[model samples]
Target: METQSMLVVPVGEETEFNVYVSTQWPTLIQEAVAETLDIQSSRVTCHVKRLGGAFGGKVIKTSILASITSVAAWKTNRAVRCVLERGEDMLITGGRHPVLGKYKVGFMTDGRIVAADFHYYANAGCFVDESVLISEKILLHLDNAYNIPNLRGFSVACRTNLPSNTAFRGFGVPQGVLVVENMINDVAMALGCPADQIREINMYTGPSVTHYKFEFSPDNLQRCWEECKLKSEYGIRREAVDQFNQHNRWKKRGISIIPIKYGIAFAEGFLNQAAALVHIYKDGSVLVSHGGTEMGQGIHTKMQQIASRELHIPTTKIYISETSTNTVPNTCPSAASFGTDANGMAVKNACEILYQRLEPIRLKNPTGSWESWVKEAFFEKISLSSTGFYRGHDLYMDWDKMKGQPYSYFTFGVCCSEVELDCLTGDYRTVRTDIVVDIGRSLNPSVDIGQIEGAFTQGLGLYTLEELKYSPTGLLYTRGPSQYKIPAVCDMPLQFNVYLLSDSNNPHAIYSSKGIGEPTLFLGSSIFFAIKDAVAAARSDSGLMGPFTFDSPATPERACLACSSPFIQKIPASQPGSFTAWALDI
Candidate 1:
């Protein structure tokens, strides 16, 4: 499923600008349209019915499209529509930044990480769109669910001759987390210890401070890890995998568990604010408008549920209208997993104000229905409309010192995955996967579970399936789905089970709910490591030992190459016939 970039702008009168588009931030588009037409922001209105699927892709890029289309509409005094074809979209709008991370860590034989030094270089194509912000997030989440005692990490955004890479699902955190996870796996293998043991020894527990100086008072990573181990029968599965590898010659089985502690806020403090407008009619029907755009992530559904709960009404009575700039202005882009934490709070605040207004009327008629109380409040000439706004408090960060609570809170999860790998063809299949997440008293269990599944699948593609090929002239070769592979139904695990943590409550945000957008994403890398485990088993059969490294998108080519064997060693190198490669093959 994909949504191509699109924008529709209709100019009215001289300075009245109107935009209809699929975007996560209408305010950003409105400002762009206004600036393109050289008019005041009040004269511009951006309307967003909804987006098909925008995993932060439309957050910033849509503004440029809307602005370009608005210029045509302004000059011609007509509606202008600009939509990119699938190929054009892929070639013009880039995806996640290709990050190269280098790190060295010191750990004990018990698999505990003592100290680490790291450097990360990101391929920030032609223009630096959000590369700086992405780099910052990479540094912030390098310690994914683990406690790094002594750490020094630096990041660099290298300019490249390619399309500018914007935002994806996990931003740059997954790349950073992958680097650390790979390091831990290497450490575990070097010490001849189980990877899970190393992870557990380094896992955060009790009240502790992060390397960035953030307070991790109620760490739930260990809880999730324990639950995942129990649910997945990890001990039994590990033994089974070992037995299978020992018995099988060509095929081997491997199992791995990964834990995650994702922060739930944007790197920038100002982007952590949200606003909502709520209006209650005399018929008890409520119309709610929030700054967060619905991109099939169930943000609107969650917001509606929040309003309904606050107003003491059924969800059917509350309706979330289309997001518009005229209703709520200056909205932050719906990224960083903070969409629900910030926007839901704004919606709840609006509903709370309306609830207070109707309380007096309801008290007069204790046994009255919601409609009757609403009518009474209307007859009493009480205000039926209110605007509520919320800004994050006490969230700050200094680059020089790198000390402060950059996140409102952390969401934790753990996943255990088992896979069967065919060493000959480098083909693999996930036998079973068990995931445990701490989403803090979920607003909607179904939505949160869907988010976890979707994000994990996307992350799986990033680490094991999706591979982008580009030409030397900065042209993308995999410009469509036919070439670029996203995880399909067949790519899913054969037996998949997801469980949210029980008896968990977060004090931050509304109703003790934490963000579920990007937390489970990095856990998908478990499949890659599991494949690595299988490769190790294959190598051992060939009398090979020690820690070996492999790059991501563990495609068939790389996987087969990593599974060293006498047969692979017997293949002669391609006789070049005095030929040299003409283009980059990454």
Candidate 2:
């Protein structure tokens, strides 16, 4: 659910407004507000103190709030503030698109995918918004972490009356990845081998090209898998789970490992630029402003660190200003996990210019205090302020042709999940999870780990507990916390271990660090596969053969249906409402 809570207040009777919105694309909101109010773009000021959480919802929707509030202020001739309650917010804001996918895959007996064809329909709701872009992203990620020789994918944005679905963390990539991962699981079941083995056999290697024709170099996909396997003791745990399932008829244990290779950068190449302004005061203190927003992702912290490192100044001497269009104009939204890579480079460029200005003063007074040198530079009327801009070079994509390098690089990861399932109740618990992620010389280990954990948790909720339901008339029923269930603290695995691949680095990014925001969410699919493994165990115990197929969420009811044999009769039509009660008899 990519929804955000926002507050907007007009400044005064003047056409200008002091708009406070929680959004990643504040400049876009500012421009929209100005245009809506028939005022110059300069009259609209958007101040984003910080966002509690955005995922991706706060970008375009915040502009709508800004426009409404500005109009209200104009009509009333007074300041107006609008803050939506949670229920209202949920009803109005969009979430991840509910996609219906149809896929046909051809595989060998050894579990290698020879070809795949996928047709995806995204529920775009009432408005187009970003649905077309999201659909393109879904097509781009249909291959997920594997390499298939022949692949064809197409996507459609299906318009409905509900609120328009917008971007989530991974945008539409997760939906596409889920389809392929599910197919791989089916292939593994048919081959009578673990899904991880199939994934390994199909994993991309040297000189491989994606469906979009992006060539790959050596990546950490295999490395992360091997490291995660060793750390999780996957083989030993599988043996133990088999033994437990053999002895325990009512309870079964299952384990699965999955890998992910997510491309970084916006598929739309124009959004790959960033700007930063750095001001050095006479007192040797610096203030840095960048286009990236801070949604608890530590992007501001990384910008400050970049400026400090580049200027050869202590971090304490640097302060990050609020993200404002007045300071850094025509900015791209902080998204696609490129916030650090893009903004960090811009800040670095600004700091380098400032450094050049101070170099002469430093050489003249090499032993002087830092403050004295800054004072000398200030006295000489040297420009202590500099604006830096960076555009990602050599990044090109042809949407019409749908071929070229859409990403600067890729982020890779692997996850292993172990689960215990109750055959009678269809209840399950995640026993353990192991993860190895390649963050490419992590800018900040703590922040990267936090992102990985948070994204994984959200993804787990999406697949296991976060079920969004709607009424017949297009009303959302799961509009509140009570109706919608997200993963709680207890839902975390009992034994969880996460490791960063230290030897990896992205040659194309700032500080050689890859984006860590959305890739780990794909790892959460491991839990779903693990649950499927448990259901397969139950099916095998009942003398059922062949592949087991079930829908998402693997809810208790769905799990029970997957476990029961074909001969096991379900509740009759008269007692259909009591299906769960009778399902225990299986």
Candidate 3:
């Protein structure tokens, strides 16, 4: 008997954790602090910087990066940079968990949803991290504004051979929302309904009822749809698409209007917690530090606005500091679009407390020396501190029974999209998108609009044009700019529409300002459906509409296979298998 060479397998060996992580922890930014020390508000500057682009990349994952870097820096006793290569980044980074969703939606022919059942299967890679949270968001937004009598929705987590995924743009809402929204599109198509017409009939367009104790606002979705349809030229575009598809028999086009009813604050009310410290110097300058990190979403800028509003000081007198544990301790991750909502409140409240102490001094010496006013106010004041948390309101919840209103308030809107596809190469383009959102009010419209556009574009890439490759050894092959694909300037749609509800502010939000972060990404799912419609039309298949839903980051090759060329290729469907289709050929 010939002795075969013995093969050795390593056991329990933790490979060097070549991990690159991100976090939304830093609220009191040092840059904001330094600026406040200089000219403060006259220039109205915010010291902001970002480590990367796209979703989960800027959220809680930064905590991992910080922790790892801290450990390396401590051990080396020198500046140690542990930047993982692209493959390592992909292997270690969390992403949009591909989801499988099934729903049975029942509605009266008039458009009121009476009964519905939602089943969500989330692919939690290697661990149950954000799956449950995403599911909660899914349940919260179920029926999406419509008052439904009997509704049951459940989510399950499935372990797979992949990296543990975390929050992306919409926290966990996008994954769950895509599943529900897709069902809506299918239902409309089955019933021969127009997208906008169906939304008018079903969405929470009626008088609002608070699900939990949080005040529910009755923002008009019906009006929003009308404004967007006309502004976006949705009807005209639809007709044009039909004509284009008719002339070009080889390719087709499709359009869809989707509604997103995202809730504000963290999924867990405790996650809504925030802390801040506001300091007023003898020079009348203020230092503001709170628990929220700025990754170019203008959080620091908004916090300044919050402080100014509360303190009655010019935007120039305030300075925000770096988000270090030393400033505001045990902070929540800034992924829930609540950076300003939570930390800004804490900052503003802190300033108000400080100002109340100074009020007597300022009034007493209307003509007194500025130095004297400072001396009296600083010495007589108690330590200045304020903390705010969005713990669920008890008046709205049956705590023991877990039955009642859960969200503080609902942020409602609908996105309409039109797209064209190529028959020869299975490529597609987003010709236009119209988004109508009720953001309550924009403390800064420029910043809010930028977030909306940025998030939407990133989501478009996730669902329509991005892909991550993995080796059988549980390694990701695609990483960094060279290998990974993101949207560029040329990929933007020809027509874009963004409308913010002008007269309203979120009653429960800090100062009535609503969050426009994560919801921006979920709207891209609307575009994905439109593209899916175009593909289906080109393929001319009706049965494919029911179940064959594709997960996103849909690169050209994947899109081709998903839309056309269903090559009868058999992949070894089993656990402990490399999830790379391209490698299978090798």
Candidate 4:
């Protein structure tokens, strides 16, 4: 996490506001500032250079600071700056929504999920801020790459008296996916079969249709699954884990494989659009500005490449200045992993327009250099600037009918994780991890790989390491790094391997590439399931069997308690007339 800062200066004849902030939604900041100051929306212009780190926090929370700073500048007629300290940010800003899932699943002897009924309640905190959208996302992704025939579910964001929870990296999809995964784990335990067996048998293969009516033929998710299994030597590792469990009493090892089929788009249909402005100078150099913000995700680089490809120029000649409301107005937040998909197309369209204008000049001198053709075109008085726009097609949803396609496309991947646990102390370390994803002809292999690695590590923190604590009075106790826990250097796996599936093509996006930002994130649940597997081994040694319930954020205390032993069962109960019983079950 990094400090979020913004500066506002009141200037110009019409009392215009020029704001500089690191935010994903500059238009939103402009609108909020204008409204707070009771001025015209056009009176405010937001300039976004880049964000140190947002993930999703700045999509909405950033407007609060921008509005406050704008108000101060308006009152004093001087520049004002607002910066949030790390500790202050944590105390005021909310994290991922805490989910309480209730579910009942029915399966066959061979591990096919026949029917599932789920009711998920998400804590929305003191106010409703995009919680309904989050709840809708949870319902949309209830069947995570699996084929559940009879599925019925409802999700609601319950109100609470606390800080409002906001958007995170995976939005609500990861939480929803975890529900079905936990059910599969329980079913495997009940049948004394491997969880991967259940996953394979229930996976969507060949031609399948989702509950929301999105159809897929020749889905690449199956290929990713098989390829991950082959590359990870899954069968051999399973046997090794069994042997390790048999030989060791105090230490246990476990392994798990999880698949992902994530939809790529904003649930709100109108938000799935982008606009760009491209200006080609007389010297043959290009400047590109798009609605997407750059937060170290390489969106600008991808836009540069797109422009270069469309204009038949070297990448060195293309420049992406900054995302500003003055250029592209009313842009959606650079979120939902669609920044590249939506903005790349807009940039390409603008470049194509300029390319067509210069085509006749190029044909006049077939062997001429690009600079010569541009010079001729400039002499011919051809326009060198263009504005482009793109909106998602056939993307709509009607919640009343529970139908329509809300996603533009799906991104698929698989991950296999292995972990060794100290049953005595509940400490664990990741031994090895293997991942395979279908990014569909990567735009930049290095950037995509970094995204996959960083997302998985963040998900690792969400699923196993990070824990939020609250007192009985609803005060947050884990309000800073000293009290909270996140993944660190020592938490990484000793051996890690990542591979991109070949021959995968996505026709819906630019350059046949799919969104890879959020797909690999849910794969981090493999680590959580692996920890459960290790605890299951310890339970079996104590003669405990059958299915058991386990919650997320498998912290050390929970992991130690999950390894139920004879000693734990032998603890004596308090006397009938003893002092007041302990309040908590622990």
Best by TM-score: 1
Per residue, candidate 2 scores C-alpha lDDT tens digits across 1-586 of 3345444455555666777778899889888988887888887777777788888888788788868877887777666767777788888877898888888989998888999999999999899989998898888888888889899999999998888888889988887898889889888888898787898899888777888888886467878988999999999999999999889877888898988888899877789899999998988999998899999999988887898789887899999869887888888998998889889889989999999989999999999887888999989999999999888755677867868898988898899999998887788899999999999898889988999999999888877777777765667778788988889998899998999997886889998899989889978888888888898998998888777667777777778778884434465344666544411210
Ranking according to TM-score, highest score first: 1, 4, 2, 3
Instruction: Please count the clashing residue pairs in each candidate, in the order shown.
Output: 0, 0, 23, 0
The sequence of per-residue lDDT tens digits that candidate 1 reaches over residues 150-245 is: 888899889988889999888898898899999988898898878998888888778888888888764577788889999999999999999999
lDDT of each: 0.87, 0.84, 0.64, 0.89
Native-referenced Cα lDDT, model 1: 0.87
Per-residue lDDT value at 342 in model 3: 75
Ranking by lDDT: 4, 1, 2, 3
Candidate no. 1 TM-score: 0.97
Residues 380-444 of candidate 3 have per-residue lDDT tens digits of: 76444444333322323354554665555667677888877775566777788889887877789
lDDT of candidate 1 at residue 285, scale 0 to 100:
92
RMSD of each: 1.6, 3.2, 9.8, 2.2
Model 2 poorest 10 in a row by lDDT: 577-586
- TM-score of each prediction: 0.97, 0.95, 0.80, 0.97
What is the Å distance of residue 582 in model 2 from its true position?
20
